[model samples]
Target: MGRMGLFRDAPQGVAAVASSILACIVLGTLLERFGPGNVHSGLPTFGAIWVVTAAASCAPWNYALTRFFICRTGATFVTLDANQFTCSLMVVLNVIGTATAEATEWGNLGHGVTQILSILVLSEITIHSGMAADTAWRVSLIVPAVFCLVTATGLKLLRRNTSTAARLDVSVTGKITKSLLWDSFEVLKDFRVVVRIMLYSTSIRTELAMNNQLTTRFRTYFLMDAADVSVLAGSFGLLNLVPYLCVHYVDVLCPGHLG
Candidate 1:
């Protein structure tokens, strides 16, 4: 996309990403803070339960929102095949890869910046606010919730102002068919797809497990207090911005090759 196209698409992508980061941070922090203490030298049973429950609860809502709302919005702005009642996973990824690639990159850059801000906020609340850790964590949770509300409001305003010249007035009028479900499974028949799924799932699980244990590991192994841990996490967030910076330069040098 050109500079104008990137600017036009950026708000939606950044808003979506910001909302996701806020949700993950709140849920992850809750699991770390309030889940039962470890009984053994691994992930606590209750923490695992919390993670599982969160995932389960989110899955249905995610499916509904993607199928009913997001896809409908996309279809309004872009033509879809007549037989395609809803966007498949590949279609969604293709939209992200092409139309919103630069905007998504900016969104990721925003995520790293937000992470650092959140860490600093957490530190300020827990370390300098003269509040108990229990109370401070709860207070810190409010920050993300407020940010989410602001993002939602901004999105609403953006929607109101968005031009409808190319809009198709599309609505999701079809039910989820058995054929659709089977078509989704068809992707699993490919060996490469299966292997990719396994690798992605394993990496995600490992990342979550490590994140759940990060504070405990720092406290136990390094004798770091909450303040020190926050500082370290903030440092990681700062380091995370480096890749996004590199991405901008790479895109500048190679243009359309980024996606």
Candidate 2:
């Protein structure tokens, strides 16, 4: 999408993310409060909530945003080349200017920073505020939700006086077809594509498994209490965040060089 188009659609996108986050948080809180289970099971409950929210809300919203809005803006802007490396590079460089491979790295760095912030905030809440781990984690989620909400509100206000022509038009030109699913399956025809997908999926699953067991591992191996574990986790997060910050600053200072 053009910068203006992206700007106009920002509110809806932010609102969708905010709503999904809030929904997951609320559902998790309710489950923990009323469900009869060990407190440790709270992690699974939150994970399940996240999966459902992502599938039901976030996925569809993102698809629509990419398809109807971004695709409609221009096909050149879409990074759908067959060369995986080129496509990956274009995704990041395209964000700043036209070029093409460091977008994936930038995206990872952004996610890592957010994750670090979340871990640190939750650790602080658990240790200093003396809140339960379950409660502190849920409370930490409020930060992102509020940030998204505020961003959505700001975008909405900014667009309040925009002309109709400048506003985002989400209407599709014709009836949608089921061919999208069939087209998506066409990717499986390429062995490389299938292998790449499998590798990516495996990596994601591994990450999720490690995240789920992270706290238990720290407690078991280090003989740490909740507070100590939190501190340790936050320390790890800070260490991770520092490199990301440096890389991000370099990328901002010299755009496309990383690509």
Candidate 3:
């Protein structure tokens, strides 16, 4: 199918869901075969490392590439909607995964499974469902090289006709000179922008850094095991959905304001 069919209105929701299911199946099989305490005796050390490495390597660039496509096409509302939708899905899945883990033998492994699935789904969408020519060439080469080594024909499946690069103004419109550095310095001299940047950076860093510490503290201070910590963390994820919902509604209610 086409990119529009896969991605739908805001982003690649359908493709993401499909990829998540497929990843879950693949990971589940691997886990059953090589996970600790599973049917097989081998540890999934390599598999875990591969997943984390792939995710960490591709994640930032994936977001940037997606945003580049959307913003170049002037789909600002679509970008906002996509963020809200993805965040909401994360919150819901986190809760469900946590609850399932707590009630079953999965423990924190359940959370890890869903997270891995999400990462794989995101990678799939970023590489395949994105407008082909608009996607970063490095990303395009890397994804198929990694995932389609066995199939070899998978690169042919990526959409070719759809590329946002055509719509984007990639040309340099202004004269390039050493004064560009001075221009940046001039902008940075604005006290209001400086304060805003600082505040935004601080909050973002705090949020990112807190997750590991929070999980660790849950296990250490509260004497919670993996399952208990998962439950607590998932509860926070569920709470996070409230803000995403509100953000969505704000866009709907106010149209061009918040979005």
Candidate 4:
């Protein structure tokens, strides 16, 4: 079956329902696998590494696509921004949040959930499932390498898209700079905005560094059984978000809890 269009006004229920089903799966993975599947052996290890790599990389790709599609393109800004914020949000959350949680206890769990959902769905959408992983893995390596290529392509195609809603209202009558490394301090309109962005970046880096080791560290230090670790991880994830999803008013009020 064909997937839903990017711009179609999917009922809020769809996103919510989809998000719920995803929660069950992630927590279930934790419950079933226990402590990141055994990789001490051969084929299992290969598959386990594949899973790990996928876990490491797929999430970022997924987030990027979502942001590109939803927020960046603004859900098919075929005429407007063409930015696809959804696609961008995925990458931002995944990069800043998922891949390098090298710093924390619950490390990347929050961002992990978001990336998993965005990528899995996008994978299933753009590429067929059987082919998605292979395609993703190939694309995963040297993400930074193809990063510009893909972004450039997206931008080029977007300009051609009559449906795009261009976010940058400013007319570019001048020459375009090929340079990517620009100073953030120079770009910021105000010092306060600069401070906010800096503080925000610092807080995220701090959280990821300090409280991100929920899986690896726990598994090592406690020497817990695989099942035990999985159960613990699952329990934490479940308690972290599941119950709130079950609540109506509570979730609507505190959106972060559901995430």
Can you give the lDDT of residue 86 in candidate 4?
23
How many clashes (backbone atoms < 3 Å, residues ≥3 apart in a chain or on different chains) does model 2 have? 2
The residue-by-residue lDDT of candidate 1 on 10-116, one tens digit each, is: 34343333343343323323222232111111122222333223322223343233223221221111111111111221234334333233333343344335445
| Candidate 3 TM-score over all chains jointly | 0.33
Candidate 2, 53-94: lDDT as tens digits: 332232334533332332121111112211222232223343
lDDT of each: 0.38, 0.40, 0.35, 0.33
Which candidate do you rate higher for TM-score, 1 or 4? 1
Displacement of the residue 223 alpha carbon in candidate 1, Å: 1.9
Clashes of 1: 0
Report the C-alpha lDDT of model 4 over 98-203, residue by residue, as the tens digit.
Answer: 2122212232244344333433444444466454544554444334223324544454444321123322211231425432223222447777866855863475
- Ranked by lDDT, the better of candidates 1 and 3 is 1
| Poorest lDDT segment (10 consecutive residues) of candidate 1 | 74-83
Of models 3 and 4, which has the larger lDDT? 3
Using alpha carbons, what is the TM-score of model 2?
0.40
Q: Write the per-residue lDDT of candidate 3 for residues 80-184, one digit (tens) a residue.
A: 122311122223442433322232222223333433333354456565767452343334334423432322222223312113321212133243433222343
Which ranges in model 2 have alpha carbons more than 4 Å from their true place?
A: 1-101, 127-134, 148-179, 202-205, 225-259
Residue 119 deviation, candidate 1, in Å?
4.0
Give the CA lDDT, 0 to 100, for residue 253 in model 1. Answer: 51
